[model samples]
Target: MIDAINRKIIAALQQNARISYAELGKKVHLSAPAVAERIRKLESAGIITGYSVKVDLDKLGYPILAMVQCKVYRAKEREFKALLLSYDEVIECINVTGEQAFLVKLAVESLSQLDAILEAFIDLSDTNTMMILSTPVDRALPETFIK
Candidate 1:
């Protein structure tokens, strides 16, 4: 179970993952070695999964953000999953229990790219496309319930 100190460390990491152990120790009021040991323990327990960099998709030449919702027929679940896995544009695919079977997040350069992706999906399964108008807020919520 995470204690108060571990929670502080996790919060700090979430804010700035590149913060050195010495700096984190200063923030959390622990020695550098102690903070290191705590972080190691968190990793061993699977509480701290990994770190990643947040990139600007548009600046990176990915000017399109589309959420493709698919209402796949029950008969083609395996095939659909395999097709999605093969598509590099698919950032994430989630299965939902409502009218839509899966919601896919795709990043691309233009409508032509989206059209190509949609054509592939339409040939494989029934899908509905919804272009993202704007992302007002998109940020990770803290894993504050770890304790």
Candidate 2:
């Protein structure tokens, strides 16, 4: 179970992942070595998975964000997963319930590219697509829950 001090450490990391151990120690009122040990423990326990750099997909020439809900044939699930994983445009693919089997978020440069991608899967799956207007609430887990 996470204790109060550990919660503080997690909170600090969430705000700024690049913060040095010494800086985090100062925020959480622990020594740098103590903070380092706690972070290592968190990583070992699988609470802290990994760090990633946030990028601007639009600036990188991938302005189009599309969400695809695919009603995939049950037997073809494995093949479909492999196909989705291989696609460079697929940023996230989730196994979902209801009529849809897979929900995928993809980035592309143009409508033609999006059309080509969906057409590739239409032979084996019933797919629906929606364009993302904006990411209004993109965030990590709120620190209050850990506290």
Candidate 3:
């Protein structure tokens, strides 16, 4: 179970995953080894999943970002998922309840590229897509949960 110290560690790591254990320990008022042990425990308990890097899609030549909501028939769900897994342009995909079966985020260099990616899904799902203008709030997670 996570305590207040763990919450602080999680918050610091979320902001910068590359923070050294010694530095992190200083922030949490623990020794470097203690901090390392706590982090190891968190990892073992699956509380700490993995670290990732944030990249600029525009700088990478993928300026267009689109959120595509797919209404895939139950019978074609597996095929649709398989096709989605094959596309490197797909940034994220989530299955949800309601009118839409899956929400897919795609990053591409041009409108034509986005169109081609969308076309592949046409046979499997009815899709509604919106180009992302600007993300005012990106990925933000609560450091501590209220019980």
Q: Each prediction's TM-score against the native? A: 0.92, 0.96, 0.96
Ranking by lDDT: 3, 2, 1
Estimate, for each residue in 1-147, the C-alpha lDDT of model 3 and write its tens digit: 688899999888988999999999999999999999999999999889999999999999999999999999779989999999999999899999987879999999999999999999999999999999999988547774511
**lDDT against true structure, model 3:** 0.92
> How do the residues 12-127 of candidate 2 rate in per-residue lDDT, one tens digit apiece?
88878999999999988999999999999999999999988899999999999999999998788888888897889999998877989789999999999999999988866899
State the TM-score for model 1. Answer: 0.92
lDDT of all predictions = 0.88, 0.91, 0.92
Clashing residue pair totals per candidate (backbone < 3 A): 0, 0, 0
TM-score, structure 3 vs. true: 0.96
Estimate candidate 2's alpha-carbon lDDT, on a 0 to 1 scale. Answer: 0.91
Best by lDDT: 3
Count clashing pairs, candidate 3: 0
Using lDDT as the yardstick, the better of models 1 and 2 is 2
> For residue 79, what is the lDDT in candidate 2?
82
Q: What is the lDDT of residue 2 in candidate 3?
A: 86
Q: Pairs clashing in candidate 3? A: none
In model 1, what is the error at residue 143, expressed in angstroms? Answer: 6.4
